[model samples]
Target: MVWIIGFLVVALFVYFAMLGWRGFGLIATGEVAGIGLGVGVILLPIIGVWLVYSTLRAGIEHQQLARAIKDDGRELDISHLPIRPSGRLERDAADELFAQVKAEWEADPEDWRNTYRIARAYDYAGDRTRAREMMKRAVGQYHHVQGR
Candidate 1:
């Protein structure tokens, strides 16, 4: 549990740290602050890291989005597609997001919405079998969704 918390904190720190770098970049611009150059120098490396991470993440998302589009045979904005909100998807859930979700449903699987998001995370991370099981459970539980 402690390890999990620690991991979450570290992940959160990485995200905000990147934002801080970006903010610093905008604030320290020469035209904006005159001292922007000086401040930017101090902040550029951090922001550069942020930019690199962002670029890479975007590329991965694009790749997944393409896969999703191909699988669905329709245009879809992958970024607009919601995930489980773990933010862990930054690295772990790329491939599955690209491959699985866009595909058609199988066999009218059981209701498992409670687990659906988790299954998506697993799917995004490329754990299709586990995701499928979760989906089956979610499908089985479908009646509950309408308070049935």
Candidate 2:
């Protein structure tokens, strides 16, 4: 899986480089419209690289936090939760679980562990937007606590 993802990322980078080369070719034309289009095209690769780098960094950080939490035996356990046919947690059970996790987070908002749990709860409850928000918070808190 890692190899596959790495290969895909490399391919994406190559594609972005090609686009950047084309953008430079356009800029070399010295026409106003070509220069404008060239600038826009060049921005695409720059933005793409930044997005990929940031996403991979966050994923690595999240994995590190998960490993630390597991080592400390602080990982959230959802084994008792009811599951639906599609392999997701039943909606009601997920909501109840989220309520419990949210209360824990509220009680000690400074704790990265609690924040991580709440993020997972939000994910399980099918609230992707909130889950991503909480996960980003958890990542920042974890980094701060680790002095990283």
Candidate 3:
């Protein structure tokens, strides 16, 4: 799995580099419209690389936090939650779980563990935006606590 992912990432970087090369070719044409298009094309690869780097970094950080929490026996356990046919937690159950986790988080908002639990609860409750926000917060707190 790691090898496959690495291969895919390399392939994607190659594709982006090709796009950047084409953009420079367009710029070499020395036409006003071509220059405008070339600049836009050039920005695409730059932005793509930045986004990919940031997303991968965040995912790695999240996994590290999860591992730490699990090692400490503090990871959220949702095995008892009712699940719907689609494999998601039942709405009411998810809401209840969220409420519990939110209270924990409120009690110690600065603690990465509480923030991580709230993030998981938000995710299970189908609030993706809030989940992502909380997860980012948790990651930041974890980093700070670790002096990273």
Give the TM-score of each candidate: 0.27, 0.95, 0.96
Q: What is candidate 1's local distance difference test score?
A: 0.54
TM-score pick, better of 1 and 2: 2
What lDDT score goes with residue 38 in model 1? 48
Task: Identify the runs in model 3 with alpha carbons over 4 angstroms from their true place.
Answer: none
Candidates 1 and 3 compared: the better one by TM-score is 3
Model 3 Cα RMSD, Å? 1.0
Writing each residue's lDDT as its tens digit, candidate 2 over 25-92 gives 99999999999999999999999999999998988988988998899898888999899999999999
**What CA RMSD would you report for each candidate?**
15.2, 1.0, 1.0
lDDT of 3 at 58: 86
TM-score, ranked from best to worst: 3, 2, 1
Per-residue lDDT of 74-126 in model 1, one digit per residue for the tens?
Answer: 53235754456665354434655544543433423342323444556566676
Per-residue lDDT of model 3, residues 1-148, tens digit only: 8788689789989999999999999999999999999999999999999988998898888899899999999888889988999999999999998989889999999999999999999999999999999999999999899898
